[model samples]
Target: MKYNNQRPVVIGVTGGSGSGKTTVSRKIFNELSQNSILILQQDSYYNDQANMTMEQRANVNYDHPLAFDTDLLIEQLSQLLDYKAIEKPVYDYNLLTRGTETIHQEPREVIILEGILILDDARLRDLMDIKVFVDTDDDIRIIRRIQRDTQERGRSLDGIIEQYLNTVKPMYHQFVEPTKRYADIIVPEGGNNQVAIDLLTTKIRSILMQRGNDKIINNKDSTI
Candidate 1:
């Protein structure tokens, strides 16, 4: 129920794995001052599989909606939008575990919720002031995923391929793709699309300025 009347502008950016959603989100973040932006990555909300063995965890369909601790993510986002601080959770893909240390995230003027499945949930979607979906070719996405998983997430090439075929592809079809219809904007080629980024940036800046203008007018009236 809290809003910029008491909260920040909430932006949701989502897409399929390796779809450059993060790149798009990063572009938006870079446009703003560090103090004005708060980024919440959806991967950080993955449900912990501590009780499961490594083998069991590896079998989990991470692309599935059930794979995320959506409730917790929703709660954390709600608190942040309510002008409250939260301890953001951290998930480690290398270990397939949640880290013990949490980041103390303070409220900011702009909050970006970045993930593959962000638009899939109505509750989360309802909170967003601006919603974006990055559209890219599946082949391109898979290639990027393979490279990222192998180099950064410490995944084997074979394992990545297997997972992509077994779960990631199917889940994207079932869940992620369908949610694209809900987006206010569809960004083709993700962050590399300078035109889309420019238009978006202009709109965001306009909103920021309007809010500032309102505050200034309110102050002047108060003195009168």
Candidate 2:
């Protein structure tokens, strides 16, 4: 995975809901940032669901591919790939909208994009140098989702169950499940899979070394 100086490597990490994709992304980001890597989350590109009334939003399936502003994300990613400067959008979960905070990201030697639907869009899939899918069992995923929504997302048990049965499970079967075929690697058991995580870390290190970036530490200057 040695990257040319002129090109930026894009790594995509995707999985179904409650698959611990975020946790995997964080681990990879930490490992790669040792070589001056920058990470982005596709969750930041979720379309403004807050603006719509509860009725409108209620009918909306947040897990659907159409819920994200893929075009805008692609445009920004394009600029980054071309080594141009761009402002990345900041998404607010509480407001459920795109926020005012804009992060300026310059070209990095490596970029990691993590989300549940990163592989769903063809354009996004084309941009990835490496793509990974984290898989968890359906029942386990549902339980995890219930815990997360109830504790972190301020959702009731009944509401969480309703959403899971009504929207999440169906969407997983329709959209997320099919995209696993596109992954270069599939990680099972989520974060508990230490062997897979170690292998990934080793691969990332080897690639950075080949790129002559082994010494690129994440200091203030490197990020700039």
Candidate with the greatest TM-score versus the true structure: 1
- In model 2, residue pairs whose N, Cα or C atoms come closer than 3 Å (at least 3 residues apart or on different chains), thus clashing, are none
- Cα lDDT for residue 185, model 1? 96
Q: Per-residue CA lDDT of candidate 2, range 1-224, in tens?
A: 22356466677888888998888877777655556577788888988666687577567788999999999999999988887778888877666677878888877777888898999999999998888999999998998888888889898899888988999999999999899999999999887777888888777666766766655544322341
Tens digits of per-residue lDDT, candidate 1, 1-224, equal: 12346457788999999899999888877765432666789999999788989989877888999999999999999997787989988897767878887888877777889999999899999999899999999999999999998888787899889989998999999999999999999999988998988887777766766776233211211000
Worst 10 residues of 1 by lDDT: 215-224
| TM-score per candidate, chains pooled | 0.90, 0.88
Clash count of each predicted structure: 0, 0
TM-score of 1: 0.90
* Model 1 lDDT at residue 157: 91
Alpha-carbon lDDT, every model: 0.82, 0.81
Q: Which candidate wins on lDDT?
A: 1
